[model samples]
Target: MLFDKIARPAMYRLAYHDPEVVHERTVRLLGRVAPALGPVSRVYRTDDPVTVLGLRFPNRVGLAAGMDKNGLALKAWPALGFGFVEVGTVTRHAQPGNPKPRLFSLPGSDGVINRMGFNNDGAEALARRLAAHGKPGVPLGISIGKSKVTPLDEAVEDYRFSLRALHPYADYFAINVSSPNTPGLRALQDKAALAELLAELGRTSAELGGSTPLLVKVAPDLTEEALAELVEVCLGHGVAGIIATNTTLSREGIAPADAHLAAEIGGLSGRPLAARSLEVVKFVHECTEGKLPIIGVGGILGPDDARRMLDAGASLVQLYTGFALHGPGLVRRVSRGIAGRPC
Candidate 1:
């Protein structure tokens, strides 16, 4: 009640409602308060633990990638009740992202559009940061993406570097070929490209003692045939799991009041994405015959959305836009709501 009525309004009003500015401020603030989050953890953390990809999650809810691209608030997230936290979408090289105003919020539509272009301080920096702070108490999944300066053909080596650099820190690695911001990044999802990439990463994972799991984050724009083929490729290459439905490019469900914001170029995420994300999760579960675990994300703003994703056969669910719009209260609500449900 306080967040929806008071805090959120104040946050949205910050910097004349620029989403990225608000995001930067929030992450910075979280990092400062991290050490004092023990009480927050006691209040919000739920104890319905489940094991997926050989990692034990305190609950089914996890902080999705893009929220903390460089893992700035590592300790703060688990304390705020995320069963686990997936950080990054970080690239191998440090690159300034697209430009200012790349991230936009759609309050009317309960969504967000961002073309953040794999912005981060490079993988080696993140590795050093993690080595210094050590891993958070909960399972940590590092999302690796190709650097913008790296040519498409060289994506495998680019991703390989990040995998090798962060191997010791990650409980799992989410291979991000799905974000719409980077030029031609989604092409990595093509069968041959994905197969080659996964094959090499599988080799790298094995070389790194083969413990950390590798999963793919896919685009919501894919057709059923493309999605099924992607699943087959993942399975063939020993991929451990799939993160269904990253943000979307289509502006199909933006409300009339927010239709003007639909012109923004980037992926769309929030209530508008719920139906398709759920459909994709169900399809992947059926296609894989439940042989592969899924960490469902996209449009999960409330307990009902999380519950639906689990019912659609996700072993776990994650939050990105939902957390951004609804705040940490949403995490507590979701963690508490889903506790005790079967994984």
Candidate 2:
């Protein structure tokens, strides 16, 4: 208990570097030791079971994508007691993400900003990892996006290629059109493009003859009108669920003094995202009239943030920044907070 109490803060301090650097170090170190994660690592593992999107979740809290971009820590992450893990915003072609200083921290505000721009090792490598890694006894969500240099015109094809490469490995797939770092990526979020892309992907997934769930991860920057249209598009195309927010470009509610790296060219996540994410979740819930499942994300620092999302209409929630700040204990805390609460 004493170790856990002191360790989270220190680990968080060490992690406040560039996202890509932190990411690479984590993969190298954990990848070396992950295989040694035996019974002792089960300290935070939870037994609570949840069924969402026709998939069984070991718990309700998940580690959102961008944390384990290559699916490198698949075996180890679940040991952290996360009910689910979303890895990658993988593209069809591997590319180095945005140049350094791509991640920044606002230590005072407990937030982070990153323009890492999807620096993944590509879909095929991730597919290989997924194929090689043992199952974590929980569902895994694989998020895919367009390559950095991919033109808007062929974005669908890029996604299609990635989908094909990653289909076998992902239990569920999240179409990520919301990341702010990628140029013209949000254009896919437009009604017509979204409809055409998703319809085709839906058909393709159907042809695979497996029960893979499909989710769309939306941006927090979207206005009510835009969100409503996206909701309509999702429902019409039979989207299985919506990850109610990626990061935001908004700096509202943040004092200039506290905005350590607010000007950083990336999406802002953590405390700054709490209010808008809840609002987006609520909008998606009411707009769908509760038919669609929304995975609440952004902020989600502690039980209160998790509870806010659930109460506002999230079926489940994912956290990256929060997990970094507070550590794996959050999964148990949030699960205990939500257990037997409601659907």
lDDT of 2 by residue, 1-343 (tens): 4325796555556766444555577656766777787664567776678789998887788889998888777777777778898989899999999888788766567788889899989999888877777555578899999998988998988988999998887889999999999999999999999999999898888888657889999999998999999999999999999998999988876657666566678898888889999999999999999999999999887788888899999988998987766666776677777776676
Report the poorest 10 consecutive residues by lDDT, candidate 1. Answer: 11-20
lDDT, candidates in the order shown: 0.91, 0.84
Error of 2 at 295 (Å): 0.5
Cα RMSD, each candidate: 0.9, 1.9
Q: Model 1, 36-130: lDDT tens per residue? A: 99988887888899999998888999999989988888999988889899999888999999987898888888898888898899999999999
**Candidate 2 Cα errors over 4 Å, as ranges:** 1-20, 255-257
lDDT of 1: 0.91
Worst 10 residues of 2 by lDDT: 14-23
TM-score of each: 0.98, 0.94
Error of 2 at 92 (Å): 0.4
